[model samples]
Every structure is written in structure tokens, then in C-alpha cells.
Target: MIINKILNVDDYYYDVFMSISESLTGFSVNELQSTGLADIYYKHILGQIEAATFIEFLNTSKTILENSYSQDQLNNAINAEIIADPGMQDMANNIITMWYLGTWEGAYVNDLSYKEGLVWNIMHAHPPGAKQPGFKSWGVKPVNSNS
Candidate 1:
């Protein structure tokens, strides 16, 4: 996408997003992309975020990724005080939250379908209204007995 153009990184836009997602959430690039979080994040950036701010965030992230040699290094870079601009920081936070929660900030909860949300992944629980635990599964000594 245009994110690649904005970041001017060697990797594709989705790959760049995957790297950021892995650094932010400790999840693999494949996991984030496969779960549709990457696409969601791209859409959010294009549709909701301010153009100049998003470009600034992408450029900052690109620089950080270019300097880091490993995943830990990337994580360190992200945690560093690289983004001093408040607007860029806010955009960065929104991207990080999208990776973790699978929803953009300010989205109404009711507007999201159960499976589309990533809270179930974080909570290690099935999505409500779909694949619910077996009968009495919650009452077992270990709530996760089915697993």
C-alpha cells in the first residue's frame, strides 16, 4: 500500500506493519497478518488518521526498523523516545492498540462482530456467541479443562 511509499522502507507495507505488530505485541508477523490485523491497521491509517501525522509516524518507524538488527532491538527502538511528537505518538499508540485489540480506537464495541475482535486471543477465551465452552465447562476445577 501507500504505507510503503510513506515509510520508504525496503519491505512491503504489510511486512512493515507485521514488524511493528510483532515488536508491539510479541506476536509473530504471520499471526498478525493472518488474523487480518494488518489490513485493519492499514485501513485505519488511511481512513481515520491524519495524513501528515501518519506519514511522520511511518518515517519514524522506518528509521527505527532500519537501525535495529533484531526483534529485541526493534522493541527497544519502539520503546525509546524516538517519537517526540505528540501527534505521531498518538498514531503509534493507535497502531499498537489495533494489533492487540483488532479494532481501531474510538470504534463502538457494538459495531464490531465477535470473531473480528482480538480480545479473545488476549484473554485465551472463545469468542462470545460462537464456539462457547461445552456445558459446565466453566464450573470445572480448571476453567480451561476442555483445552
Candidate 2:
């Protein structure tokens, strides 16, 4: 059938993502949501790795062009490195965050250098049992040491 090729491509894409996510996080895509970052080693580690990997990838790509490496070779190398890097997996999670946040109000990549730490601090610096400042106040978290 003419549609078979497209259907197979869709299935292949889903299978690839599912297998990779499961290997990295030990949770299928469906299972990872609603789980606290702290409770999941793979998810937590992946996030950090992803950020660092992307930063490295940008530097590497720049270096390759500066050094006059063949564009095709450089592209292949970079692709391989990203696939092997756990950090890229973590970056995927954050990319999802960026998507969820929409356009970021015209903020550029440069803004991230200044803004990431500030946002991180504000999100995590709340007092014990405190509701996040901008988020809805759900009174008193139940007794969970991690919370």
C-alpha cells in the first residue's frame, strides 16, 4: 500500500525514541512523566549531561569549521558524539522545557548564560514545605523527606 511506507516510518521513529528513552531512564516515555527528578537517577543525570553535551557540541562544531575540516566529516563526527553522549539525553528533557515555555519572550541564547542560574536558584531555593513563589499554593506538602 502507498501508505505503508509512511506508517512504517512513523513506527520506526516511535520505536527508536522509546528504546533510547527506556535505556537511558529505565522508564518508557509514558512512565517518566509525573516522576520527581530526584527520584529518578537516569532522568536527573540525563538532564545535566544533556546541557553539558550541547555546550560541548557547539564548541566542537565551531572548532571544526575554524580548522577547515570537511563539512561532511565534521557533521558525521558531531552526530556520532551526540548519540554517544548521555548529556544529549538530558538536553532533550530541557529542550522539552523550552518548548513548554514557548518563545521565551524574545530572549536570545546569550540570555541563557545569565538567566539559567537565576531561574535555577529561584526554583530550588524555597523553604522546606514552601510552595513555589509563582506557582499555586498547595498548603503544606505531605511528609516526604525528598519534598
Candidate 3:
């Protein structure tokens, strides 16, 4: 609750993150939210992303979205090299990585938990060391997808 009060992160931030997530991962907001990815991403951003850069990214992204940019345009804007500062770029990259990997790779890597990682969700495979696939699972195709 303290973080919620201190961050004052509203639905707008989550909406912006969802839009960016959809653009980056080609996944629907509903799908991401259903897996609790949205909350995970938001918390990661709050804890790791620089506040000023995050706010700027959100504002710029919201403007681009409101302008009715095509998916390609959205992607281009989100991935644009407009962020000149290294710190901002790191923040941006961290957000993108979190969506794909489902874990934040920050200064303190140990803070990330394999159980909650997103890589397994994307790979449709369990975390390598933490959870083993059931017996003989390796012999057959992965249940989620071939890839």
C-alpha cells in the first residue's frame, strides 16, 4: 500500500503498458493480463524504471496511440531511438525484456524469481532447473506449441 500511494500509478500507466506490451509481444492485453503479466510488469517498472523516463515514455506512447497510429507505427515509435540517455534506454529495454522474459534483469539479478518468470510462458516449457516437465515429456512435442 505504501508503494501504491507513493507511486500513484493509475490505470493509465497500466493501459499504456498493455498497449506497449501488445505492440512489443504481439499478444493481446487480455492474454497478458490473464497471466498476471501486466501486474508483474507494472511492479517491475515501478521498482526499476526511472520515474522521469517512465513518465516520458508513457506520455509519448499515449500520444502516439491516441493519434491512431497503425501497429507498425506504434512499433516504430515504441522502438524508436528517440531515447538518447543511457539510463532511459536501459529503462526502456528493461520493460521490453520483462515482457518477453517475464523477469527483470536489473542491477540485482537475484531479485528475479524463476517460478514467476515469463520465459516459460513464452517457451511453453517449464523453468529448466526449477520445474521439470512430467515423465517422458521430453520425448513428445511440447503441449503448448511446437516452437
Candidate 4:
């Protein structure tokens, strides 16, 4: 109930989830948002974990972002607080997994999530079965062919 209210308060908290995710996943916000699964993963994680812990995770991430002066500081702070803290670490790892693998709790969230996995983007390849390459297009893919 409160998260619904807080989420509506701004551009999805100007997407605090995105900021936390960028710091955690080593992916820029643009890259994360580009996957089209950011919001879905956010809500998905909420469903997988306790809401209050996730919220505290968000706040801790926000504080780290606000207080840190450089990238190293940000990384250190995240590792120390968000990743190392017992309450947040599992959720942190799960978020990273969701971003990279498009799955939550070892299961794919949906076809869209699968197709849009960061793994595909990072590996510069699509899921083999995601789209028929048309037998003719099967040669070594052009470097830019991942999309």
C-alpha cells in the first residue's frame, strides 16, 4: 500500500530502483532501462522478497549514492552496505541475476523477460531459439546482429 503511494510520488521515485540497480549490476541506467524489464524486475523482486527489506535496500542504496563522492566510493559503499549486509545481499544477488538472466528464483519470468535478458545483450547474441535466424542468415553473426 505504502509502496504504491511512494511509487506514484514521482517518476517511479525518479526510478530509485534504477539507481540502485546501476550501482549493483555495473550497468548504466540507460542500459538497464533499455532492456524493458527494469520495472518488471523491480516488481518481480518485491514479490520474491519481503517488501520492507527491499524498501530498506532501496534506502540504503540511496544513501550510498548520495554520500559517495566517486565511483570507487560508490562501489565500496554498495559492497559494504547493500551487498555485504545480510538483509540485503540475497536480494541484491537476486536482482543482479534477474537483470542478467531474466529469471527470478531460477525460473524465467516470461517470454519477454527471457528475450530481453541482459545476458543476451552483454554476450552480443540472442537466445538461440528466440527468433528463427532464417536458415540463410546463420553464418557468423555480424558484430551488431544481437538485436
User: In TM-score terms, which candidate is top?
Assistant: 4
Instruction: Score every model by TM-score.
Output: 0.70, 0.25, 0.68, 0.84
RMSD of each: 4.5, 14.1, 4.2, 3.5
Worst 10 residues of 1 by lDDT: 108-117
Off by over 4 Å in 4: 6-14, 132-136, 141-147
**Comparing 1 and 4 by lDDT, which wins?**
4
TM-score of 2: 0.25
lDDT of 3: 0.63
The best candidate by lDDT is 4
Candidate 2, position 108, lDDT? 27
Report lDDT (CA) for all predictions: 0.63, 0.38, 0.63, 0.78
lDDT per residue for candidate 4 within 3-106, as digits (tens), equals: 67544525444477898888778899998988888777776777777767777878877888889999999889988887787768887888888888888889
lDDT of 3 by residue, 29-56 (tens): 7867775556656766777755666777
Show how many residue pairs clash in every candidate, following the order shown.
Answer: 0, 5, 1, 0
User: Which runs in model 1 stand beyond 4 Å of their true positions?
Assistant: 1-11, 82-85, 108-114, 130-147
Better of 3 and 4 by TM-score: 4
lDDT, model 1, position 114 = 39
Candidate 4: 10-residue stretch with minimal lDDT: 5-14
Flag the better candidate by lDDT, 1 or 2.
Answer: 1
> lDDT tens string, model 1, 1-147?
655464443446546666665666677777766664455466556667565666666677778888999877876777774446567567677766665555567662233423645566767777777657688876766544566
